[model samples]
Target: LVASGIDTNPWCDEAKKQKKGDNKSRKDVPTDAATAAPSIKSHSDFAEDTATEDSDATKESLASSFGKIVLWMGVVAVLAALHVYMSTPLTRGQVVPPGAWLSYCGLLPFDPECENAYLNVNFEGKVIAYNSNRDVAWEMQGDVCAAQVGSCVRGLELRDNGLIFVGGKRIRSIRVPDKSVSITPWPFAEKPHLKISRK
Candidate 1:
C-alpha cells in the first residue's frame, strides 16, 4: 500500500492517535482517586472533634451539680451549730434570792405516790418549816427544814458564799428567772424541777 503513493489508508493513522489519547485519560483516573483520599480522612477528623465537644459539655454539667450539693451541705451545718448555741443558757452562779419558795413534784401534781415537797422561805430571807403546800403559817427556823427525808426532799438554803444548799446538800449550779429556779442536784436525784411560789 505504500508503493502506490495513494492516501487511501490515512484514516487508519488518525484512529491510532485517538486510541493513544484515550489510554492517557484512563491512566489519569487512578491519580485523581489518590488525591481524593485526603478529603475522606478530613471527614473522619471532623467527626472525632464533634465527639470531644459533646464529652466536654457533659463534664461541665456534672461539675455544676457537685458544686451545688457541697454548698447546701455547708449551709445545713451552719444552721445546726447556730441552733445549739442559742438554746444553751448563758447566766450562771447562784441567782435565787431569799424569800423565793422552791417546790418539786415527781411526774404529776398532788399525786400521793409521787415525790412532792415544798420549801417555805420567810420574809427575812430564811427557810422555815411550813405545811406541805407552803401556804400555811409556820414557825421560822433558822435551820433549813426539808419536807421529805430522802434524796428527793425539797429544801433550799442560801449560803454566805452565794452558793445554794438543797436538802442540806450543796448543788453544782443554779439558774433563777423571774418566777422559777433551776437547779442541778446530786447524782441520786432523777431530774431537777422548778416551781416557785411567793407567799
Candidate 2:
C-alpha cells in the first residue's frame, strides 16, 4: 500500500501542513502579544508620570502664595505699630525746646511762612495758633501748663483801622504811622489790658 499510494499520501501530507501552520501562528501570536503589551505599559507609565508632575506643581504654587501672604501681614503689623507709637503721649515732665515739635489750633493768617507754621504748643504738644510768626519765641516746652504765659505775634493783615483782632484774645491796637506795630489789650477788652507799646 505504501508504494501504490506514494503520490496520494493524503493523511501524512495533511498532518505536515497543519504542523507548519500551527508553528507560524504560534510565533505570530507571541510576537503580537509581546509588542502590544509593551506599548500599553509605556502609555500607562507616561500617564502616571504626568499626573505626579502636575500634583507637585500645584503644591509648589500653593506654598509660594502662602509665603507672600505672611510677608505682607508682617509689613502691615509694623506700620500699625509705628502709627500707634507716634500718636501716644509722652511721660510726665518731658522737655521739648523751642523750634521743637509743635501743634496749634485757631485762625491766624494766610502767608508762606504761616503755612505749616509751628505755633505755640502747650506742654501737651497741642497746636494753639494757626498763623504764628514766632520762629522760636514763646514755643512751649514739655511739662509746661497749657494756657500758661506765652507770647505770640500775628502775621500781616490789611485793615485801615490800625488794629488787628487776635481771635478770643482781644484786639491788638496798632500805631501804623510808618510800619505796622500792634499793642495788646486793643482799648477793647473787659479785663485789665496790656500796655500798648510800639516795636
Candidate 3:
C-alpha cells in the first residue's frame, strides 16, 4: 500500500492558524507612548484642582460684596451730611446786637409756615428778613432796634420804600398803614397760630 494519504491533522492546522492570527493582532496594537491614549489624572489630583477653583471663586465673590457695601455706606454718609447742612441755620456767632440778631420759629427749620420765619441783623446794621423757608423776603441797611429796645415789629412804614423793623422795651402797640401788615417776633413754638391782620 502506497502512503498516498499523508497524515492530515485538521484540528492541529486550525490551531496553528488561530495562534498566528492572535500574534498578528497583538503586533497591530500601538506600543509607542505617543500613539497611546492620554493617561487619566488620579482622583486625588482631580479633587485638589476642584478645591483650588472653588477657593478662588469664593475669594472673588467676597471682594465684590465688600466693595458694594463700601459704596453704599459712602452714599448714605453723603446724604446725611447734606440733610444736616440744609436743615441747619446759616448764621453763626453772637446773636445779640452789635454782633448779630437772629430769630426763627416753626416746627421745622425749613417750614414755609411760621416755622421757617427768621429775622437777622448783622453787626454792620444789615437787616435781612426770611420767610419760613429761609428765602430772603427783603433786606436793608439800618439799625432795626433803638437803644434799650427789646421787642420790635417789622412791616412797611407809611412813607418808607420797604419794610422796617422797630423794637423797644417800652413800645407796646403798633400802627400799620392801609394794605400793610406787620410780622411779629416768632415765639419759636410749634404750630403757632400766627395772624396777619389789617390795622
Q: Which prediction has the highest lDDT against the true structure?
A: 3
Candidate 1 on 78-169: residue-level lDDT in tens? 86665433222213233333455444442234677644444444444345432345443222233343556554323454444544455455
Off by over 4 Å in 2: 1-41, 93-199
Candidate 3 accuracy as TM-score: 0.36
User: What shift in Å separates residue 184 of candidate 1 from its native position after superposition?
Assistant: 8.8
lDDT of 3 by residue, 82-173 (tens): 55433444321212244433445322444456355555655545556666556665554444454454444322111122222323122223
Give TM per candidate.
0.30, 0.32, 0.36
Minimum summed lDDT over a 10-residue window in model 1 is located at: 181-190
lDDT of 1: 0.48
Ranked by lDDT, the better of candidates 1 and 3 is 3
lDDT of 2 by residue, 1-199 (tens): 6777566578789999999999998877755666657645578899999999999999999999999999999998986665433333322222233233333211223434533333333434332322244443221112322354455322221123333223113333322232232211211112222233334
- Each model's lDDT comes to 0.48, 0.41, 0.49
